[model samples]
Target: MRILVVGAGEVGSSIASSLSDAHEVVVVDVDPERVESLTYSEDVLAVTGDGTDLDVLREAEVEKADVVIASTDDDETNLATCATVDTVSEAFTIARVEDTNYLDTWREHHGAFGVDFMVCTDLLAAEAIVRVVGLPTARDVDPFAGGSIQMAEFEVPEDSPLAGETVAEADRFDELTFVAVIPEGADHASVPRGDTVIEGNARVVVVGRPVSVREFARALDPESAASEVEDVVIVGGSTTGKLTAEKLVERGVSVRIVEFDEDRARELAELLPSVTVYSHDATDPEFLSREHIKDADVVIATVGSDERSLLAALLAKREGAERTIAVVEQARYVDLFETVGVDVAVNPRRVTAEEITRFTRERRAENVAIIEPGGAEVVEVEVDEDSVLAGRTIQDVMADLPAGVVVGAITRDGQYVTPRGSTVVEAGDHVVAFVQADALEEVTSKL
Candidate 1:
């Protein structure tokens, strides 16, 4: 796909970096310094010019672009750029909206202007808080098909009855998808085949019926009753950390935030009097010990710096914090946290990009989320008649499935059906399959 991305701000840079792998990206921005500083292994053509000018877009061949994304910090600039692109091409246009309250009006009013999608980071961050507050036990959650299905992250505790159980051996959840298993020492995640035993210490990632995800989580740890989370300790007090604290407080979760920003600390102490706010560096073992970090059930790091966030998680883990969720913004630092045993990396920019791509993809129906290490996710999509596997059963079609891919569940209408040798996938049926980045093209080839 040819993508014309306007703006070189944080969101735009993240978008260009993420999409450069799979698309022909041409980035335009007024700042020559930012454009010149961008380094990408893949082809990313950067042009220094005002994005609102149609002539500049024409020079970049915006008409040939499959999609145009306007991500300038200024909302009016983005809107104007989107309007100009609409005049040049029928390509899909996405605008980074400023006032989140104007989303409905802009979405409705901009059809003639060719703005197809409105992305607001505030709303994206807020939705992240929503997921955490809604499911406090979940470390990470990916919404799909407009929240109809979710790929949720969790760990298989040592006490879990599923310690040695395999996906094929045990009766799988009816509405749930068994996604990927993140083993202890590998750069990649593996597909969970039935009979693939669940290791006691493995960081298992699952996709299933929302009820099944919860039930499976509870079934793994019988001691964790439905609403049994006692307390949570959050490391760092950045904007994301503050928002997380507010969300957790609203859910009645006893929250403690360890931050280095004294002013922000005082602000939080005043706003959330119930929360214990401490002004201290989380990487400091002494401060962690004084705060009783070892007693918390979950520890999350949302500090701005990746190095500090990883260090904080490591210190918390050494202090006996059970679950350490780390905030990771830079793509290069994913490995750093992985080595440091960080539970999850909340890259909202990547999440937001995937959300925007959902609107541009013409063939995909009701996509929910994208899984990491490239291409692994559980997608519940209707099989239109034009699809390749409309009349095929799972056994006949999935023979060439790659190592990191597997089918988990199939649904016809609202009823969940167990896949088998005789089960035929007809048009209008939805399939939930787990695929790795390497297997994605194959998964789509079979449609």
Candidate 2:
């Protein structure tokens, strides 16, 4: 497949880097330095030109592209690029925008601005934060199989019942699969074997039905298993924070938003009548104490600056907040946020990249999640009659699959199956599998 990406910024570069591994990728940008840097670092063709111009699109051979991704920082530029590409070819056009207004308009009117798909960073980040709020102990949570199946990552606490148990011994949930485990202080994660002992503080990834996952989470930490989120405090009035507050309010959860900027705070207060908006700096300990941050069931920091968000989250934790979630823009700071006590870290750039990469995957895959950033992925694919995966038992399939890959779960005719060796995959079944980054291509080909 041939893909043309417009923009060489963080999101664009990330999409190109990931797509280049499995497909022919061409990246366009006005900045020669960024284009040159990508050219030197990735296996993609870097074109230094204005992506919105027809001549530039022709130069990149957009007519031959299977997909054209417009990801410029400017929403107008991205829309224009997609429009131009649509005029010249029948390629699928994906446009990235930070403004919810543009996204809402595009979504209501399909093909508006010549965009087949629209990815909103703010909405994606907000949704990620909301998922964390729903499952407080999960470092990350993603839904697949049309919400019937879920993939979640949790840190094994020192006192967890399964802390010292091996994978085979800790298999208590009939509907859940323990896919992989990342040992404490380890740089890499692996598929857990029967004898693999889960150590304290290790990250455990599991996939199963939503109800089963909730039960498994409760078993992992009985004290923090209340899945109902009552109080949520957002420490920023940015678009991400506002969106999150809106979602929580719709779900009937009590929400309070704290903003440093008086004007923005006033706007949010007027827009969100159900939410409590405070015009105060979250970085100040006095303001936080006055707001009773310690009573918040979940505290989310989505400030513009990563440092500010991190600091606010730390303060929330210090104030005895049950869970803390921070929006960190820099990918490198994600681990640091967790290390410093943040329960979850949401990166908009990475979220956008993951969405775009899912669109680039084969049609059989209904959903794709970048579980461990660039290291691991979990894909939900439909077993087609023509595919090699159909009409085979899980044991038979595993024998031919590459290492570091596991069939996590399957859904057939609306019924969830925690795959076992004897479980046979039928055509039209949705199969979710965990694949290591290096084995993704091989596994996808077989599926």
Candidate 3:
């Protein structure tokens, strides 16, 4: 597929990098430095021009593109880019917007802005945060097979019992499958073997039924795991924070919003009747202590600025918050935030890029979860007669595919199917597989 990605920012570059190896990718940016940098960094062609301009689109050969993605930071710019692309090509257009109003309007009338699909960055980030909050000790979480199957990543704490155990020893859950183990400081994840050790500070990725995943979360840190999170404190009145609180409230969890702005706090109080909104500076340790933040199940910081969010999250953690989740605007700071004691750092751009990538692979993948930015992915596909797994047993299929491909789970007729060596994959079965970065293209082609 020939993909034209507009706005060579973090989200656009991420999408281009992920697809460049498998598809013809062209990236456009207004900054000459960014364009030149991307040209050298990735295999994709980068053009220096305004993406919303007709001349720029023509220069990028938009007519031959199979997909045109508008990922500029501004919602108006993305919508304009998509609308402009539609005038010259029949390529499927996707727009990435941060505003929910645009998303709601587009949903009411599909293709309203000449966009075939749209990804809302804030909403995706909020959903990602909520998913992590659902599972205790899960640094990241993605659902597949209509929520029946979950791919969860957990950091093995230095003092945890599972720290020195091998994958085989941690494979006690009946319905869970250990997928990958990313050692500390590693950029890529390796599909785990039975003998792979679960070292301290390493992150483990697993796929299984939600119940089993939840059980594994408890086992990861038994003393710290809670049956359910009862209270959550959000340290901002941003869109992502509001969405996160809304979802948590739906789950019957008590929520509190600490917004420094008095008017915004009042607005949030009106918007979320069930949630407690406090108009005070979240960074104030005295205010946090007064609000019982130490007793809260989780503290989320979505203060809009990376520095402030990091400060708020770390302070909350220091104040004895059970867990801290921060919304990181910069993708590069995700690892730093987690390394500094933030339980989870949700990158809105990364989440948006992953969502857009899922649609780009609509030919086979029903859903896609990027475990690590450009490292590994968990993809869900419906096996057809032409698929390699159609009538083959797990063992035979493994022998045929690349070494890093692991059939995590399968669902047929809306029922979970545990994948084993003897289990044969039938046509129409929804198969979820963990694919290392290098093997993703080949594994997807075969599956």
Candidate 4:
């Protein structure tokens, strides 16, 4: 597929980078210098031009493109670009509109503007990061189809009911389905362990609809209260942190932020009137103690420095906070926090970059993620009527696929089915697979 990405800024560049592996990506920006410094390499075609201009869109061959994404910084310009694309081509157009005002009424406005989808960076980024502050016990959450289904990762606590239960026995919820198990001290990373007994605090992964999943998690340990966290404290004043705090407030949840920078702290105070802001060093144990971090339901550290963030979370956790989460950029320290009892270590750049990725690679990347440990991955693809595996079975598809990659299960209309040897895949079904990173392109052709 050919895609035109407007604005070679951080988000636009990230979006372009994610699609360059599989699609023909064209990047257009107003500033030639910005476009030049931005690297997409020869994998992507870069051009210097105003994204809102008709001539520029025409020159990029917008009509022939499969998707046109307007992700310029200016919201009005993005809307205009989307309108232009809609007028000229039948391609799917996604506008990167950041203003909350437009996003509030997007579902209704999108159809009138011929916008196939609207990328609300703030909304997505907040939903992705907010829970880290509210519920740090969860390692990761994959929300599907506007949150109709949620796949959440939780580690079994030492005193939980799941402590001594086997994988099959531990997952007893009728609604909650056990997806996969990444066992402790396993050399192979993750395994489809069925009869393996779960140790206390074992990383148990599950998938289910929203309310059912929460109930299932609550049943695992009633005292932990891991599933119900209403109070949250954020320790950062960055754009990512502030946006996360704001979204939580909109959901009628109480949130407090401790920012060290006076100027940024004041900005957050004025912008988010509902949230209480404290202008003190979040890393300082003295200030944290004064605020009584022990009573707070959750403590999230996003102080820009991985060391500082991790230290704050550790201090807060020691202070008796229920859960502690940190935003760390360093790859080495990702699992370090969880290992040392600090709940979550999120890579903000990776999270923010993937937001733009969804804009460019919509058809593909039905469930795309940049996995950890050697940058390997598992991607879920949909088998539409036009797909190669439309009328084929799992066995037939496996014969054509390389040995490194393999399909796992079938999701027909949001319902997951364990694929047996004779399981056949019909049209309009989504295929979840565990794939080797380098062979991603090969998986696309077969799907």
Candidate 5:
């Protein structure tokens, strides 16, 4: 497939990098330095020009492209670029916007801007934060099979009993499947073998039913796991923060929001009557103490400034907050935030990139998730009559698949099946597999 990606920013570059391996990718950016950097770093064509210009799109052969993605920072620019692409080509158009209003209008009016798909970065980021809040132990969580199956990543605490146990020894849940073990300081995650020992502080990825996942998480960290969330504190009245608070309030949780701007704080107070909104600096020790942030079950930092959010999260953690989740815009700050004691760091750019890439996947795949950014992916595919996976046993498929690919679970007629070597995959069944990024193409070809 030929794909043209506009704007060469973090999200655009990430999409280009992920697609360049299997498709013909061309990236356009106004910044010459960014274009030069992408050219040297990724296996794709880099064009230097305005993405909304007809001549520039023509130079990149947009008419021959299979998908055109408009990912510029400006909402107007992204919408206009997608409209321009629709005028000159029959390719599918995707636009990335930060406002939820545009998304609602586009969906209600049936592609008002000629965009076939629209991705909202703030909405995606807020949803990511909510998922982490619900599952406190999971560093990241993704649901598949209509929410019946979940893929979650959890870091083994230094004091956990499973820290030094092997995969076969640690896995005691009948409903859970251990897919991969990501050791501390490792560049890549490995598909777990029977003898793969989970070291202390290592990150482990698992897939299973929701109830079973919660049980497994409690088993890993009983002291930190809560049966239900009660008190919650959110810093920042930004769109992402407001969305997070709204979701929590809907779940009947006690919510408090700290906003630096008085006007915004007043607006939030009026909008969310059940939530406590305070116009004060969240980084101030006295302010946090007065608000009883130490007694809160969860602290979320969604401030616009990355530095301020990091500081607020650290302070909340120091004040005895059970879990801290910070919203980070910069991709590089995610690890730094985690290293400094934040329970989870959500990156909007990476989340948006992953959502956009799902639409560009093979037709057989119902959903695709970037389990470990740039490292591994979890794909949910349907077994069709012509698929190589139909009518095959798990043992036969594993022998034919790549080394790092593992069949996590399968659903037949809405019944969840923990796949074993003798399990058979029939047509119309849904199969979820964990695959290394480098082996994605080979794995998809066999499906």
Candidate 6:
């Protein structure tokens, strides 16, 4: 597929980098610096001009593009870019917007603003935060097979019992499959074997039924229980924070919002009567202690600024908060925040990129979750008659596949299927497999 990505910002650059491996990608941006940076950093064509201009589109050969993505920071610019591209190209159009209003408008009319699909950044980020909060000890969570199957990533602390155990010793769940193990400071995730030892401060990815995944979460940290997570305190009343609180309220969890602006606090109180709203500086230790933020089950910092969010999250962690989740705009600081005691760091741009990149994947892929940036991915593919595993047992099919591919879970006719070496795959079975970056192309072609 030939993909044309507009606005070479973080989100657009990330999407281009991920797709350049499997497709011909072109990037358009107004800034010459960004265009040159993208040109040298990724294997894609970078055009320097305004994407909403006809001459620029012509220069980029927009008519020949198979897919056009508008990912500019400004919502109006992205919508106009999509509309402009639609006038000259028959390419499928996707627009990324931070405002939920545009998403709601597009949802009411499928092809509104000449866009076939729309990704709301704040909504995606909020959903990610809620997912992590729902599962104890889960750094990341993604649902597959229509939410019947889930892929969860967990960080093993140094004092955890599972830290030094081998994969064989930790294989106690009946419905879970260990997909990959990423050691501390590793650049990529590797397929785990029974004999592979899990080191402390490492991360593990597993796929299985939701119940089994929850059970595994308990195994990772027995002291943390999902049922015990009742109170949540949000530092900022940004859109992401508000949406997260709304979702948590739906789950019967008590929510509190601390906004620096009094008017915004009043507005939030009116919007969410069930939530407790306070107008004060979240950075003040006295204010935090007075509000009893230390007793909350979770403290989330989404204060719009990276430095502020980091400080707020760290302060919450220091104040005896059970867990802290910070919204990081810079992807590079995710590990730094986590290392400094933040329980989880959610990058909105990264989440939006993952959501959009899945649509450009192979036709058989129903859903995709990137385990690491430019690393391993967990993909859900429906097996057909032409698939390598259509009628063969997993063990027999393993001979034809590379070593990095691990079948994580399968679902047939909406029923969960536990994958085993002896399990024979059916034609219509939906298989979720973990594929390392080196084997992605070959594995996707076969599956």
Q: What is the C-alpha lDDT of each candidate?
A: 0.72, 0.90, 0.91, 0.71, 0.90, 0.92
TM-score of each: 0.76, 0.97, 0.98, 0.68, 0.98, 0.98
- Reference-based TM-score, model 5: 0.98
Stronger candidate by lDDT (1 vs 6): 6
For candidate 5, lDDT tens digit of each residue in 1-447?
899999899999989988888889999999999999999999999899998999999999999999999998899999999999999999999999999999999989977898999999998998888887788688999998999899899999999878899999988988889988899988777899999998988999998888888888998988888567888999999999998898889888899999999999999999999999999999999988887899998999999999999999999999888899999989899999999899999999999999999898866878888866445888999999887788989899888888888888888899999888899999999998899988998888888
| lDDT score for candidate 2 against the true structure | 0.90
The residue pairs that clash in candidate 3, if any, are none
Residue range 125-177, candidate 2, lDDT tens digits = 99988877887688889999889999999999999988999999988888999
- Quickly count the clashes in candidate 6: 0
What's the lDDT of the predicted structure labeled candidate 4?
0.71
How far is 430's C-alpha from truth in model 5 (Å)? 0.9
lDDT of 4 by residue, 1-447 (tens): 888888887567767766778889888899888777664353788778987788998888888889888877688898888888888888888877767667667776656466787766555556667754433456777665445555666777788777788877765655555645555654332434568777775666566665666775676666765545677888887666787887788777789999988998898999999999999987677887898888888787878788888888888988888877777766467778778877777765456556555445445557654444323344566678877777877777778877545454566777766565477888877765655556667776667
Off by over 4 Å in 6: none
Return the top candidate by lDDT.
6
> Model 1, range 1-447, lDDT digits (tens) per residue?
899889887678766765565578899999988888764443699888889998788877998998899988788898899888888798888987746555768657767445887886545654664475455446567665345556777667667788788876544576676668876554567877677788776667776567776777777776653565557887877667776777777877889998788998898889778889999888888888877899887788878788888888889989998667777777667656765587656665666666665554435546645655543555556788877658887777666455665665666767666666567888988776676766565565556
Worst 10 residues of 2 by lDDT: 366-375
Top-down lDDT ranking: 6, 3, 5, 2, 1, 4
Global Cα RMSD, each model: 4.7, 1.3, 1.1, 5.7, 1.0, 1.1
Determine which window of 10 residues in candidate 3 has minimal summed lDDT. 368-377
Candidates 3 and 6: which is better by lDDT? 6
Q: TM-score for candidate 1, please give it.
A: 0.76
Candidate 5: clashing pairs of residues: none
Q: How many clashes (backbone atoms < 3 Å, residues ≥3 apart in a chain or on different chains) does model 5 have?
A: 0
Instruction: Report, for all candidates in order, the number of backbone clashes.
Output: 16, 0, 0, 1, 0, 0
